[model samples]
Target: MWLTGRSIALIAAAAVSLALAALVGIPALLYVTGLCAGLVAVAVVLAVLARPRLVLTRTVTPAIVEPDEPVEVVLDVGVVSGVPVVAGHWRDRLPSTVLGTATGTVPVTGEPRARVEYVVTGRRRGSHELGPFSVSVGDAFGLVQRSLVAGGRDRFIVLPRRHSLDVRVGPAGATDGATRLHPTSGLGQDDVIARPYLPGDALKRWHWKATAHHGEPMVRQEESELRPTVLVVLDADPRVHDHAGFEWSVSAAASVVAHYGGRGFDVDLATGAQQVSLESGHGLQDALVVLALAEPDSSPLIIPARERTTFVMTGSLDSTSAARLLQAVPSRDTIAFVARGTSEDAHGALAAAGWHVVVRDSNEDLEAAWAAATGVPA
Candidate 1:
């Protein structure tokens, strides 16, 4: 509830009339005071009773998105139980992570309904809430004002900015053609001919020999090789990365996942404290979110084993961590994308440790940078 300027002026006028009646001993002035007071009381009641009841429905297009991506929000306003207000304003509450214009004049139409639209850009990562819409309306005489609030909070998941990358993941020539991949095709001797039966198994393709041995029906299915695994490590030590640098590292890590997990290869995302397997498929979405929310930690970097392919995103490598990495990985086996600001001594340390060290790609010109490094077999 709020008192408008008009309401304040009316109260002052009523007080003046009452004072004049007492000063001049005029009973007629009492009628003026009573009428002024009555008008103010009536306006207050009208403002409350006549204010429109706004029911809000909020819709956000592409509820989940990468950082800096535009997301459209449409707000539908429905009037249910009060006098329809022609003069009113609506404003939406938004968090700092999202940027948009959230206030506008309420529309007037033949029906008691309206729509409001605003495009917001996600400035940061994580799940952000956008709402608790409010509308303000005043009485016909404009003596007083009131507001009505309605609507539920909508959550928008913002992922780290994903960049274009053309480089292939996993070690080159690590597996023979037969072991690396075997596509399922029309029935033939080369194709896999025996597997446990599934609900949709075709009767003609059943393998009788395996079924007789196992005492159950077996079905012929395509033989696909296990995907090669890659480990993408993030050097997010608090001593190295500040806010901007940390974001760049996170985006780089996400691009690595997109390279491996996006293409049906197995990937593991690792920080100092945790590691998550990001298997290709719906797992890609979960992997991106993990990178988006990644922060600088105090834990020491974990050196992955020599068997799996390893890619590291880091600002600089000190001698101590470089020595530890050399002990775990074979010569020239690990690849390190060091930031532009990395010192010469750090580069020497990594090279001495047998890492295929490359210049960390800049956020700008992402594809070109990635291709330049991973274009050659590692």
Candidate 2:
């Protein structure tokens, strides 16, 4: 490419002044002007021919960072032949989303070799590509410029930040089971009943009813049954809240799934993008890995109603749709964990449709909501 218009204009003016001085027969002026013009031309040629011999290597302190966190990017520039580098400019190419309206140039100067460090804050969650950085080298006269593009690029994955909650879920009789069984001792309507004390029963099991009628102490016994199954549905709506809020919700959902699975209940997770079912083994770690890679999307409910406890986590609910599904599967218990800013009417609608509703304002509210829905002591 040819020199820029400004460079050409300056060179032309210097040449014209030198020629006029020579024609006017001013010996001293002509000699000085010619010398100056020749110097400028030689300087411009050197600057234009000055090939950038520097190599650039970038190192990001952390290849992955959480949303809203800061990541440091360091660039090392070294001259191949030990040429003393005076002053140069470094441009670390960043994504448009990351750079926004900011300028790209990063000033660099050193004694032949140096490293430049910069910090970039992650404002969103996703994969961001860094680099194709370039280094520009020029002479002191600023007449010519030469640049070299870096060879490789770096990639960074910005994950979402999650919050924790203290909560548990299980069936009535069995601590960890696939079927919901009525508690033999609790206030509930079920076919199971308590029996009188036996000879091998402990003193704590004594019942006074048989003692008063038959003049003997009786103990209470419970009926045995299978465990209840639970399914967790996560609504990953990107437009519902900010990136941080969405990440927190994902973390809360993963915790809840882990909590229920630990208690021995058959746990299944349903999200807008994927579905995971842990029918007979512990799979919390695998489930979390899936959750980590899941991206937010806006979609309607995709979980089908079954004969099990279904926990729905969403910012909002469609009452009529939820009610219809609940009506179809009356044997299964339905719970709606409404996220912050969800309409109150949605909860009311779920309640009217014979489904339990728990509204959460933050991660703390998640614990309270889970306890209320599962009747588990927090």
Per-residue CA lDDT of model 2 for 194-308, tens digit only, reads 3332112344545567556655343344445333356777667665545655665676676667666664546778777477877533775566556666677765546654556
Highest lDDT: give the candidate number. Answer: 1
> Global CA lDDT of candidate 2, please?
0.58
RMSD per prediction, one decimal? 10.0, 10.5
lDDT of 2 at 264: 52
My TM-score estimates for the predictions, one after another, are 0.68, 0.57
Task: List the lowest-lDDT window of 10 residues for candidate 2.
Answer: 170-179
Per-residue CA lDDT of model 1 for 1-378, tens digit only, reads: 787888888888889989999999998988988887898898777666764676889999988897788899998887664653444788899998788889998777667678888999887887878889998777667776777788688978899776766434322322221222223335555556455442223456577898888665564545442234567788777665657667777888888788667656567777776777865434888778777767788776555444555677776556665564455443244577766666677779877655667675345455554554555332
lDDT of 1 at 210: 82
The lDDT values for all models are 0.68, 0.58
